[model samples]
Target: MEPDQVLSVTELTREIREVLQGHIGTVWVEGEISNHRLQGSGHQYFTLKDAGSQLSCVMFRGARSGVRLSDGAQVQVHGEISVYEPRGQYQMVVKQVQMKGQGSLQARFEALKRKLHEEGLFDQDYKQDIPKYPRVVALVTSPTGAAIQDMLNILTRRAPWIHVLVFPVRVQGQGVEKETIRALEMLNRAEAHGLPVPDTIVIGRGGGSIEDLWAYNEESLARAIFASQIPVISAVGHEIDFTIADFVADLRAPTPSAAAELLAPDVTELKRHFESLSRRLGGQVMTLLDRHEQTLDFIARGALKTAPAYQLQTAEQAVDDLEDNLKVAAKEQLRGLGDLIQERQQIIVEHHPRIMLMEAAHRLENQAQQLQQKISHKLERLADQVTSRAQLMKHLGPESILARGFSYTTDAQGNVIRDAADVEPGQTLVTRLQQGQVTSTAV
Candidate 1:
């Protein structure tokens, strides 16, 4: 190389930056932190050192390191290796940081999470809906643990009718994942084993450190949960704690007690609901009957009264008596329904309340349909009577009398002259014939 072909300082620095970035693009470095400083702009500047050498690092505000940064702390950093061209110094552009003790475990966790996410294990479309009223639930956990006790207490208090099956297994430590997976498989094929099939399975344990909870993060356990036929609830830790099992399970409850709460409905609330429905149904029936009675009264007054005067009083009395009888019958029927509901409520402990309520409602509906048909038949009969009376009245009308060769005379004021004494001498009159009228003068 000749002196005349020497490189400029700017060119040299740019070439060094390119070479460092191209060769050692990204890396994870473990060291002790020194000279750590946080700027008002939320950027962190620190020096990572060991007994041998030190390296400059900068974490921008947008980077999420998760761990707190301070001098003298042992930490692991992930970033790109690049040179700051203006300063001509190579530094790590930090993207993430973790404590030295958790760095490897956290890395593995992140890698598995990303892999499963890409495989669609966490997709919402794959999630099954947990039954709102699960009839049977299976719990897989340490039988002696507080988690099982809490869940049992909650289930017993909220829904004493539900059947609970407990599968005891180690919730932590080595080979626990195999026990949990086996429990899930057994519950799914429970009928083949002469055990009752469960509507849901809840796998839970109390809160613990990441190491203690590591079994839940196993890929095989997650796969088993994903493949289970029954809906699975993951209640492995506290609210803030999460595991791969949580992601793959059909539903996630923050705690074991919460899982039980989700599965059970309060019996008292259900009873009140049934009672409210009974009352509303009874009230509606009464209202409908009353409206029908009013319609009957209107028909009797308007159409039945048009019959001959001798029959009019008798028809009105009959309609009034029928309406009173209908009212009494409806009241009796409603009273019987109320009594049936009370009796069923008393025996609810022996039979499923839902089935009992449904049966009662179905009977009430059938009775209402029958009553409606009866009312409709009665209305049809009353309408026929009205038609017959209308026809009779038409036949007995003045026009029919005129057609039968009977005629009436009206005086000058258009009043029917029923008797000869109603006319005076020389009074003008009009006599109506069958088809015409004749003007006449009294003689």
Candidate 2:
């Protein structure tokens, strides 16, 4: 037995605080809170209590300002151990405090969600688009759960021809994370092998409390959903119950039944679309046939219905009628034009002269005839005058006088003697008579 040492309260508390300080500096304590108050300085003063004990907690203004706390709220606290010398007691200096139980789990979930979001793992770019028409669909869930049953029922009702593959997996509890990862890997392996691979995968479970749905919130499971090659539809819990898997999956359905409806097509809608297309095609074909028949009827009633010789005879008759009409019109027009010209000529004659041009031509011809008669008479007169003048000149000639009474005597050279003194006694002489000249010698 150790002997007890009596000491003052200050020393006793100081020793106690020294022992508590080491242990409390790094420990997690869980309790329900009370007497929570915010001081004027913005520090928090609260009491942590349990069924058998209570503890005083002080969060300073700097450390507790952003912390939201309330009375009767459950919490887990972490802090260092210290003693206020003035108060003469030991207390915890809280570094951090968090809501306990399910609230803590929710906070962790939100943190991881934001982290994965920043990495683009939960982005639409990473999500696979659901196939418009899935030929083979793979389902991942508890084999005995109602979710699987609902999905199977919906798939059969919507598209009976679609093939279904079941990959049994645990939807809750301890080993679920590995099973989910395994199931996705199996689907990928089947696809790589060219074996029967599912076009879409439905991964989900029925609704429950958050604890029952915690496995879906695991980061490992979320990563598996992100890495899957096939498009995934998450249908965990009811509509309001969301999990990390929902954000990472390609699609989120409100319920398990809705997920099945989304995975398959609507039979009634497809039938309606097919009927509309058929009606349009039938109408087009009928319209084409009707137009073809109309064209054929038009060709049958054309000019080819008549004989070639009859057509030629009709054309020739038309030409003859046209020629006769043209000739009649031309004759009438010519008669009218001639009457108009004659009328115009008569009017001109009455206004001016009856034969202006004819009178002028007659005058010209008469003048020409008078000129010819005058020219002929003048020529005959000129000829008679010329003969008389010539006869007078010849009768008065010197040779005529010589022939009458005198002789023109000349020498032997035949020169005439004009005077008696020109004669010589020994010279030969020529005498001019009316008939001829005679040559004689002077004696």
Candidate 3:
């Protein structure tokens, strides 16, 4: 505060930067991006502007983690305000970036929405239908918030005895997303632990700013909602508020009261419906009975013929005819029995002892003749084969040649003498004739 005090340009800039950083911290500023430029150092420089004002901003490549934006696009910059000493200018050093106009919360929400939507998390086929009258309704939200009370009141007014369990959660601030996810998973586990499991769940909180509602927009909560075994109803904020949880839930209720209405049927209306159904059923049953009674009356009126005596006479005539038929049948049976007896007598005569003996002797003679023929045929085949073999032996062996008066001469050693040099002078030789072997001396 002294007038004699002097400050260097660098010092002044540094001081101003510190003041801005302390006051602004990391603030979110929304505007359209213009003069967007990328540097070789993997950093981006841009100016954020609106219809009335513009602000300088710089974002390092690390902060550009999502879809890239062009110059004419609206965006939001989350960074700290700082003064650049060299340029003597003030700017926001962007730490994070997202599309603007849709709001930072909405931008992140839509991005996550697109990702999960592509994953089929928001597909109608994957969603289960909410029960018209759920036995147990679980509310995953702040227990003390107005939303819970509103839901409880609506449920009580509609279905008087329907059960409601309030599971408390942090719906805003840091770690809110995790807490919400935990509540959902815990309820799912309740059934396995022999505790009450909800048939349907209503998860949300009362309306607030986009920041306050950001927990419902988290990707983790969206995934958890998709995975819940029970059908979920998203009842966050008022009729105008929308979140990622709403899109992913099986049913989306504009308000907590509306969700309660969806889960529980109106008792008065249900009773009226039952009564109407009962009346209709009773009417149908009565009509059927009346029709059956009319048929019975008609049948009773025609139980007997108009001339009952004539009908009785006709029945008597039929009995007489049956008796006559029985008598004729008995006579025919007697005739048939007589014929059968005659046939038996003829068969007995034919089966006498002498006749049976003659038949047996004839069969024996025929069998002997057949056996003799088989034996003769077998002997002829054997005789032919024996003669053929004998002829072959005579041709192949020396017997035929010997019988033709030819003889074989062998030396004393039993080797046949094919040449004169094989025989020695005065050596005994064996000369085999047709009938015998002769001994002779060789000169």
Choose the strongest candidate by lDDT.
1
Candidate 3 ranges beyond 4 A from true positions: 1-103, 304-443
Task: Write one digit per residue (lDDT tens) for candidate 3, span 91-119.
Answer: 99998776654454666777888998899
Quote the lDDT for 143 in model 2.
96
Who wins the TM-score comparison?
A: 1
- Clashing pairs for model 2 are none
Error of 3 at 142 (Å): 1.4
lDDT of 1 by residue, 2-68 (tens): 9988988888998998999899899999999999999999999999999999999999999986567
Model-by-model lDDT, in order? Answer: 0.92, 0.85, 0.86
Give candidate 3's root-mean-square deviation (CA, Å). 18.5
**Candidate 1 overall Cα lDDT vs. reference?**
0.92
Worst 10 residues of 3 by lDDT: 98-107
> Each model's TM-score?
0.48, 0.47, 0.47
**Collision count for each candidate, in order:** 0, 0, 0
Give the per-residue lDDT digits (tens) of candidate 2, residues 1-443: 34577777888778778878866566667798899898999878888899998888888866732236889877878877678767886677777787666666878888998998898988887778898889999888999999999999988988888899988999888898789889988897885666589898888899986677888888998998998888998989999889999999999998989988997888778789899999999999999999999988876886546566777788899999999999999999999999999999988986665477678789999999999999999999999999999899889888769767876787777687888788878888888787777877776
